[model samples]
Target: MTIRSRLLLTAAIGMAQPALAEVTLTRGSSPVPDGEALSTGDLTVQNEHLAFTIAVDSQAPWGVPRGAIVDLAPVTDGEIALDRIAFADFIPNNWSAWPNTGREVEIVTETPEKVVIRITRDFGEADIATTYTLEEGSDRIHLVTEMTNRGDVPLVDQMSGFTLWPDSGYILPVPGLAGVDSGSAEDALSDRVVAYDEDWFIALHAPYFDRVEYASKDLYATHTLAPGETRSFEGWLQVGPSGDLAPVVAAEIARGDIAAGSLAGQIASTSGPVEDSVLVVEKEGVPYIWTLTPDGSYEIDLPAGDYSVYATAAGYSDSAPQQVTVAADGSETLGFEDLKAPGLLDFAVTDSAGEPLDARITITEGQAPLVEFLGRQTFFTELDQVGGVQASIAPGDYVFTVGHGTGFLTEGEEVSVSVASDETQEVDVALELIARPYENDWYASDMHHHADQLEGTTPPEYVARSELAAGLDVIFLSDHDSTANHGALAEIAEMRGVPFIPSAEFSPSWGHFNAYPLSLGEPLEIDTSTATAAEVMAEARRLGADAIQVNHPFIPYGYLASLEAGTVPGGFAPDFDLLEMNGPDDDDAVFARAAQFWTQGQRIFLSAGSDAHDVWNDNTGSARAYVHVPGGVSADGFVANLKAGRAYVTRGPLIEPEIMFGTELRIAPDEERSLSFDLTAVNGLATASLIGPDGEISSQSFDKAPSTATAEFSITATPRTEGEDWVALRVEDTAGKTAYSDPIWINPLGEPDVLSQD
Candidate 1:
């Protein structure tokens, strides 16, 4: 039977008596073989609201190929005009869609009210069963997707659910792509995964309150599943006219049908009030975490069922997760009174001038990170705001590594303090600021940063001091689509003698970009998740943005490759100035891609950022852009220098490339017979390579450690058969610290080169 005729039948029956209508499911085989489709076959589901086909092909029965959601629109009119490339499934790792290889599907049950189908692969090693149900007289379908591990190996980084790729012209309620650990109905309600398209509205309801992520045209959920365990997700997809969905969301919340429950608990082992304790609950191999107030009590809004709960603090040993059960909407109060006590360690840092200096610190237990806090803010640990460092740590020997950013170096110190239940210890360290080759004029800046804006977050003033403590001369609070903190941050930067550049991270539907030097008003008139990359760049320029940078292009929705692919409508490879070379982790792929674009004659500049959101956990300016503003550092000077390509990005080692002939820094090809630049580093260096034309043409390695090195090469005046050639340098020190210089154009001899675009 055809799906349209089945939908018409359901609608006719439901018109007589709303609640009397029942869902009907039909099984059929595609043109492809059964093994290629879902093992059992494909299933067609239809109701008044929408009609779609679920394919359980063996290649990956769990994955929904393009056009899975065949139809969706208001219940009255026939299916609205929209893209049919909607898919669903469980992704085990990153953003790449799961192929569901070596998997098969089984039809568990078929009824009017619900249809349950299980998709499994690897000879029953893993299984995910999804039940689709439709209510009479309603424009929504309830989906309950559950995944279980039947194999001996544990399922790592397993994230499951559906992603609907509807047509554009919709708005995401939130700024970013995802939200983690949404606790209350109001909290989840504020960030509804609903998209409004003219007269129609499509929404994804998370009744039980879990981690939900949605783009302009996509919706999905993620969680890990373990061996012999199952992780279930409950939500509803509502499609109807544009109006209030509060009632639908509220009803779902009250139903308490979601997978997890609420866990309320308290911290009991601290000496005083339990300020700043983290509660972690792991259920079915999925962990839900919450940060509680410094007070003695806490609450876990959504606790996965049959989970273990624990508490952890800076210096205290983590309390093992105790197994507990929490019912939906029901609460379970738990406590941690036996958490291992920790010795208090205090720090006092100073500069060579005997003055206090805020220092970036790393406290390691053995060699691993002692504490890595999560929940979307800054993660680097710094002592600038607190004016000192203090920790409550388990009584054990640890190494306290300290260094002032860029200009100073301080060695690590071994600390051993024993405490009997309660005791305090103190330590002191001084970082000596050594003279560098370019400290006189070059200034460092962390161009991308975010502060705690959710609730009870540190003020922007404190964050400003943290930037200063990290030895940053300039800072840009490029919060996600909001400049609410920039005003206060600018004031604080003034007082702290640091230049604050006003900027916002333009989150276009295609990718993320950062626009700088914004004006005070109702924010930029650009909705990144809905607008195209070209439209976003045009809008930024119209709004007087001095520059726009592509941020973290290696991330999930990075625009570089997407634009090249032309997958997103209205998206094109717009000419953007600076490309981000640094993020939370190292991505050589992004760096390599940027180089490929540059070598292909795209006039791209290089920039780096710490991407620091949490000051205490993230190094504010770990990866910084050193801009050479020879005259003085001003707002305009900073931006102009960057646009002019007078900058180099660095993490630890310092690299500067100077194309010199006689006394000139920039030489014309007619005068570029030979050029040389001195590469200097504070650390012992081993090798330096000069990159040009085809690739690394020349390289030098040092037998003995040298504080400085030089690379010289002859520039050819030959006419090239390809695009323009360029030159740059990459240097690495004995400590493995490396830096890449901004590329300098090696123009063809006698060719008239346009130096500036503006």
Candidate 2:
């Protein structure tokens, strides 16, 4: 029998009747009044081991009873012994919110030598019972659970549950299952702060870990259980003292790798040709169809509109959604690409020394060539596999070049190619690289996050790995009110060459603010964290931060407004510089509002932040954030871009709207100044804003750029009291677009002869 089954067996058999004293004082005292079957029937033991006590306070349904305790430091019984437990100190630590924990608890030691622990709130109760038996000269503990409802119906499949051990750090046994659903708290999707959320448990949500949560790369999984009418689960909690127990439990659960479960939904039939076990299709209101079965000519009937279909089997994947406009005939072929779909070629790069680079490479204009492979049209690409390179292409001829940041490849390096869909082709190119004129650089980083562990969530590696993959320039580890994980991430980022800024998301009663360059210690823990909006600005300056940023101001975690009261106990206000105008997957409202607030919060510099704990979905960020250093891309480069106001956020467009000497320049203390744009429409519409043209003080309305019909328009600058000032336009439009020009220094005429011309 499985260990779980065996343990549960003991619980069931012992509770067959409430007779026999049902408990003993092997190590402590109880609340059952010792030999008296008293009132609510709750059992407890206190100071049973060393100086601590274990208590289980049970009460009548919908009510709380008094707790009983027994001090164990005074016990001298050496033969029947056990360690003490602290059930009351249980607190879940994770990124997302879970059920509020309950208080009153009770632990029972039955006469037949069984341990029954029950924790209750006014609404419900959960019971875990274990019996110790002597077998073959060894003592075995059998455990089982029985839960009851104090209200009308069963508790909805909930995210309520808890399990922990002594802080000394022991590996959790495997071959076992979580009492709550085994979904996940964080995964590649939540950026790991929620930690390790995977595709398997689409709806289930209680996360499970084997010793270390990250062991899943080796430990595998199968279908997760859903809560039904009295559904019972079983597993073995193999005992082990140390080391990762993932492989050990995985092998014991199933002999081989066939553990991922099959879906029972209507869409399960469509899952067959999918790769990586993932399917991505965008529809207005309908959900995507998923199939767990292995083969079928799946047909999707849809009402016309724009859509994207991505299918994956194992890890092979394909994507491209279409927006179909039905003709007068009211029909169209929303082609489902099988092996016959347009081919995708993976490209890779590395350093001049031939090291492989993990970066996003874009192919534009359909001007790139195609190659043939396996008797079909295909595109060729490459991946840096252990320092080597390769490519795949559809059968065709065309010229190709690279864009965005430079790697082993340079800009405008054209290549012509042709291939038959039947054969594989091999190609290799070497690169000569150069550094930028500037010595120092700037960086990019996400500065807000929370840490939760009692919930089996918050895998730190996901936070580290996603940024590495997304090409984020840097990251600031700022857990609210603490820097506990700072040392660990710093060491890890160094190995990855990404700067780990010591930061704090300190808040006051007004708003949330971030402090950077704070020496990787406790420089900014707050009484509020998001309380005083102004204080955040002041703190950033006091701490010598290169920049201060405000975190998500629109995420209504049920506190859209009315947080000034303790109703929203945790938030605070803070000081700042830059503001997060954009985050990963920020919607238009979120983006627009952030921009509006930053414009209103004039003294703060504005920037984009992806409060992402996961970067598994960063494909939309191709043009992400790139700063054109008068040098190379690095942490220093990112910071410099922010300080000089040379940074613009985008996924596509590159805009360059500058000021000419005569047409766009004017100088006057009280009168408005005007800056002109020679303007070039490089890719598409570029939106520009005149920033701090008035003494590091932004003129209102600079946040949202009015839709511009032409490529250039003169922003009649709003001038503030100024001596020698700065002015520049920040612009960006739809897909892959952006532009930030150098600031112009406007010198007022009568302010002393300040002209020094050679």
Candidate closest to the true structure, highest lDDT: 1
Task: Give a tens-digit lDDT track for model 1, residues 1-758.
Answer: 32234435766776776443445565654321111233345665555554445554322111222223333444344332332222333332333322232445566667665555554433135665556665545666677766678878887654345544333223334223323322222333223365443345566655333344433223344455667887776766676543323333333433543444455567766465455665655545443223343576775445234766677665566665688876655667888875556666676767777777665565544322112431111222333343366655555456656655633233333343444446787767766664333365777788877664311134576577667667677867776566778778777667656677888776543466778877742366654434556777887777668888888776555667455535344646565888887653544565566568776777677788876654654567767787877777887788878867777776655654454110113334454465565665556667877776577877878768676667566665445688666666677777766666677666555343323222
Ten contiguous residues minimizing lDDT sum, candidate 1 = 58-67
How close to the true structure is residue 626 of candidate 2, measured as C-alpha lDDT?
36
Over 1-758, each residue of candidate 2 has an lDDT whose tens digit, in order, gives 33334334765775674533222333324332222113333343322111223333322110111222221111222221222211212211211121222445444433333454444332223322222111111111122222333344445433222232211121211212212123443332101011111211101111232221222111212222223323221221122211212222222223222222111111121233332233333334232223222342333322233444443332122333344442221333333444222233334445467755333333333322110011111122222142232344433443444321332012313444444344555434433333221233323344444332211123455455434433455644555434556677777777766666666555432344556666565454332422233444565666556766655544422122224322233444433455454433443333444344433433333455444322322222333333434456555556655544455444333333343211124444454533444222223343545554332233222223323333433333334353334454555553334434334444444342232211
Poorest lDDT segment (10 consecutive residues) of candidate 2: 190-199
Residue 310 lDDT, candidate 1, scale 0-100: 75
> Each candidate's TM vs. the true structure?
0.57, 0.43
Top-TM-score structure, candidate number: 1
